[model samples]
Target: TEIFDGFSKTVSKCKFIPVVCGSSLENGGISNLLEIIAKSFPSYISKKHFKAISKQDNKEMQIEISENGNFCGFCFKTVLDQFNGKLSFIRVLNGEIKKDDEVLIVEKNNKFKVTKILQPFGNKIEEMEKGVTGDIIVLQKLDDISTTYTIGSKDISYTYAFDKLPQPVYSVAISAKDKNTEDKLISTLHKFSEEDPTLIVKYDPETKQNVISGMGELHLEVYFSKIRKQLKLEFETSIPRINYKETITKQVESRYKHKKQSGGHGQYGEVAIRVSPNKRGEGFKFVNSIVGGVIPKQYIPGVEKGLIEGLNNGVLGKFPIIDIIVELFDGSYHEVDSSEMSFKIAARQALKDAMTKGDPILLEPIMNLSVYAMDKYTGDIISDLNGKRGKILGMDPIPGGLTLIKAEVPHSELLRYATDLKSITQGTASFELEFSHYSPITGKLAEQVIEERKKFITAEEEE
Candidate 1:
């Protein structure tokens, strides 16, 4: 009893977490840990109030954590059971809730009845009639309920603040092996994403592949393993291709005339455009500088549309073009032979002609990388990143003899970094990646990217 008192004082006064070590496989010391937690932890009533946002006035407020107040809680975790459907595990912060009570999903403003509340016991659960303050209860059949969602009684109109999810750093292109189960695979992946918001699944239109992204390789593999076991589905996964962009370096003026004379009314249109490099990341812009009705106003939209469409496939590697401005300064049209189609064709040709001479270059996505590893492995980490064309920003010695290494690396070079880092640090290091900006690639690297793009296009055409 004296030792327990000292430990509790240390925890409450110093805000320190007492570590309880035990072997889960052996089930040793488990009961003692549980007893300590139940006895030493402070009751919910002791926590005077919880911070929350009032939805009614969009202001910050506090909700008292007491059984006398209206029921309010937030979902901390979710589980999708094949037999029982979605189960939302909520930590009640205020008041008490009973079966058949209507509660509002604060964020969604939707009401749902408390159908069945259960207390989880390892792999099983036991039904409960009512849940009060500080109780962690699992509510079954809340299909739309997700993790971090705030729930409150009809009278309560406040939501607890939850931390935002981190951005996914690793990705893999996935495809169903059977092809017939593609829809099922996507639907199942979506359901899994709902259970864990960190897992993201989407289709990449540029690469024409379905991609699944998560925290790391292991994080993605766990979901894949679950899908394989639960649905008996076969799937293939590969490193996703980098989404490189194309841009020009110089300005050039070009013109194109489309004339086809075969029938009574032949198609005829001419376009003159000045293509100039815009500021980086400003995206594509179109300007019309025509006067005296050189090109009819009606056909101007067609010319703009043509230039925009032309950007989808740049002259260098067919990647989408960005940060370029196209100005329609001069053009001509025949009264009877000219049409929007003819102008569109001419405008597209003109842009293509200008791009080929404007010194086009490939731009690769740059990622801001932060690596956390032991100081002993810092040298190896720096050397490996330098070999991968990473620019080391700096390194700081953090607590626990760990170093935080920050760097900027190209996305293509990081496709397999998660696996490589594990091997390099023996699973003692971790890293985060976020897109920084697009940087131009030149010389052999640019040539290789263009060549690979050509091969991809040819293979796709053949298929």
Candidate 2:
């Protein structure tokens, strides 16, 4: 099993090994993966055991392997199978608890009891006591228990949390296959996400996707692959799309009047509003300027609610609209029929109409990327970063001709940068990424994205 090459002995090198096995229809690969883990994975004795830091003190607590060591287990990940209900998994670090043995799940200085314990195979069932150090066991029907919880003796008051994982750099629009299955899909996804700290789920109102995003594309691939067998749901997915936001470039004022003549009561609501773009990332703000009760103070919230809702669903091809302010400087509200509903509709209509005249802009996310590469390729690395619209922040030399480079670049430019990095650096480069502030998009790029979204909608509508 020893495979070595010139790359291994290279002075400047970045390395990673993926332990993987899988089969499309038949699932022997998972079994082989289990076997490999059993044979090669470090046990509690071999692993550097950790205890979460005490709440009262910043000091981290360590777990001792000796008999005197406290009974502690880390509930690192959780899985909620639709049929199986809930699976709260923990790795025993010191003392062990047997099946039917109750344990407390500690998190944020709060503790909850495990309802029952189950041994996991392809599926779950009752098992012998999980009484051993380093053994993994799962608990079921736990309501308050969650990931990163410590399970041990109550007297052992505290443990340290693990390092915070990197924030998710990429996102996609996701939703259940069907509206009827939305709740199940969400519950399943949340429980599945409990196990993997890296994956993040976000609801993007612009694209209207219940996006399940992870470190990279491959991370989410495993999640969707198991959705059916475990979660017991067949889901439909929207095409993955980047989250884009919309903002205004100029300020404008306008009025909207919703004068409706219905059978019983006529709805008449008038609003005079001014719209302006705020600083980036500030979100939305509403200023009530209607003085002397020209527009009743009570209806101010109605206009505010409408504007807030509009911000969520952008004016441009359903992107998230952000960084804007609206002021209700003057307006007239009907005492009889003018209510929050009428004012809300009027305000939304006013905003859309005003935005059409006011200059608007599309904004895209920028990413802060850091790369570690061999010193030999420093020159080449700098060139590549510039090509991706990246500005180098700093570079520091590491053990190898190995250099760490910090840069800020547009997220769109680096969508495929990970693969390119490996190829350019002979598979010896590793990089980290974070979301930087966004800037305005040029007319050409914004037009392109808008056209692409419209084309997709048109094609789907045709089908």
Candidate 3:
């Protein structure tokens, strides 16, 4: 029972291949890789292990691979190249897929001709006719098809897809070195995002920065290297920022009015809103209170939208605003100029004002960390986690004398933990993060972060 509880799975697609290559450069060992790839791998048609039994005949039927074409492929990878455009890495699941052949993408509910079908001979691609079922073929120029999309002929029906990849645990903020590279960086990173589903790129409006997050610093570094190759663009990176959240401790109310008169119509909108702290993770809430048409029903969503956008104003300070309800209880609207924009802006300002008085505190992400380490470093690792405000749930020894440890630690503490752990345990320690509930920080530790925030803001303001 203990073994089952502490077990971790190691998955591999094809492990039978023998790897033998010399030199750290020139991309060698690839020759053996190809031989293994071509011969070691199984073909759907030739594989004799698969058998289907029929009840009436009590006989097994083996799907035969003949000259008859049934055109079926399972998507292996999705590539989004800006030049050649999107391509799908497909494995012929059933029949032969050839160049210039018409194929129906059943997943997309559309049909597209195979612009080109190339087989992987090592890394070099070779054009082939009707890649037999079992051959891995490159499906080019299929814009809509994604990874795992099963493409088949109208007559044949068989599906095969790969297992899902692991989730990304590391990420960081990224930006172009120059203004000219902004568009290029955006487009190139998006292509990379499509190629690897785990790689993510997000634009943070508060930070006004492009954040590129992936499995690790190396993962992001490789992307930067590719960006240099793809677009000839250079980049500047910063330490990954901590995802801090702000929450209020008590209920509070605030009101604001925006009225302007210039030439044509006047702008008038008033909002009286109450803010209350919700339980952690509940997120910001909005309520409407209009009895005598003080504010129109249609304008309510406009106000909510504005408040929602700016509710994270406190977010940059590493805090999340949650459980606060706002009401447009009292407000006057101008008949001529009262519009959604005016109300939205008024609502935004009101929320900002209320946030200041809400006594916000920062909350950091907690990770349920499971570490596999040798017994020699167990004491050191546990002590280190405890120093970072981590709580050890328990520890159990595994088959290899490596202890499986469960603990809850803050994300900030584990930024470079992978490297540190490998060093301490001599490449034997490994850990995975499962995001747990967040909690608040106290003492000088919290103060250090506050100072760091001020510096971050000052740097941004200069920008």
Candidate 4:
């Protein structure tokens, strides 16, 4: 009986339990020494001998051991406690874990020492020194740990992959009411995103707002509401502006000379570059074709870097410039004043001039949407989608009188669509949206977008 209690204590310390059973008729009086050895099984034993333990054949019952040793646990959930700071809820899969053991979060390439392990007992938590396979324990001070991380021992070779968390589809542009709350709100949003993988926080340059994306509208509303109630933080949010892109339609050559003389060395550089339209989705490409040392190699990277950064704010509506190739063919540099800074300024000026002559056009993001609703609201859903420049692929019928409608709609049209769909379907419909590809905007719609963008920029400049 002492052996049984000792075995339990040892198992509790190691965070795992090994079951060793044998018939009384055979292997009679297996010593308590076996229990001491069981605590270190698979880890302490040689791989060859450990594998052999499972092959033992006997007339009576046999206790087999495994070789791979339990060393698997993933951080499934995280919570913030007023006293504890941060806690990671980990479920052990294959190996034992102890309070002082060092485990690697293979995904994050981070090593953390388990400060304190606690096992949940209903509403309260009890300190646990060790937990073997099949035991769930909570560890503190795992601030960087998240649902995507897999915790294992240092020697483990295999990396455990946690299930893919849900991706955020609906995004809202959020901003604090006052400047004082902005810093605190940003910090809290980062912590919220770390705690919940489904929550995403990003700053949108186009809209100039901090955007928080989540699985659905309700999911994001719950998070913002919780912040307002618990943290006494107040913020307002609206649908974000669509991030459009500008690309060229033809190849054009342009030249720019940047000469500025101040108190210090005068800046003087001349650059000639060719801009060409690339295939959709090819992104931006830079090539230095300078021969006979038209431009020094050292300054060539400056031109490229300048062009790349310059593309972030495009000519049309300040969107990113994409799907274009810029070639630096010829340039002149002044011996006394020419430097990387001068060449960079010349390159940006040349690019802007070339883009103006290269027939720049706007590209909008299209999203593939899947809508699930009852048959009664199918007509209304189709009509609404069509009005938003959606192209319906097809409609499939499912069981329970539900219809699945698939369509590709422009991203701008779907910003406030979640609420609209709910109203149209009377809360009986749900939908999902994912980015598909960039499509060209032309005619009156393109003109309207350009005008709005110019007006926005003018207002911002005045502010």
Which candidate number would show the highest lDDT if scored against the true structure? 1
Off by over 4 Å in 3: 1-71, 77-87, 98-110, 145-149, 154-161, 182-202, 213-234, 262-264, 315-320, 332-337, 396-399
The ten-residue window of minimal lDDT in model 2 covers: 3-12
> Which runs of model 2 end up more than 4 angstroms from their true locations?
1-51, 54-71, 77-89, 93-102, 108-147, 152-159, 166-196, 199-203, 210-239, 457-463
User: Any residue pairs clashing in model 3, and if so which?
Assistant: 98-130, 244-318, 245-318, 245-319, 245-320, 246-319, 246-320
Better of 1 and 3 by lDDT: 1
Clashes of 2: 12
Which whole-number lDDT from 0 to 100 does residue 150 have in model 2?
Answer: 70
**lDDT for each residue of candidate 1 in 251-344, tens digit (9 for 90 to 100):** 9999999999997999988999999999988999999999999999999988988898899988888999999999999999999999888898
Error of 4 at 261 (Å): 4.2
What is the clash count for each candidate, in the order shown?
0, 12, 7, 8
Alpha-carbon RMSD of each model: 3.2, 7.3, 7.7, 11.7
Score candidate 2 by lDDT.
0.74
Candidate with top TM-score is: 1
Instruction: Please give the ranking of all candidate structures by TM-score, highest first, separated by commas.
Output: 1, 4, 3, 2
Report the lDDT tens digits of candidate 2 across residue range 1-463. Answer: 3433432323113353444868847865887777655654444575455656875676776755743466787777787666877677777777767654545555644555444556666554666555577667777767666677677766677764767777664455566667798977887777667777778776765555687767655666678887877666777655456677888889999998998987888887899999998998788888888879888878888888888777765667667688888888888877787888888999988888877777877888888888888888888989988987778999998884689999988887876676677779887887888888988887778899889878866786897
Model 3 lDDT per residue over 259-331, tens place: 8889888788888888777777666667787789988887888789888877666743634455566666777
Estimate TM-scores for all models.
0.87, 0.72, 0.75, 0.80
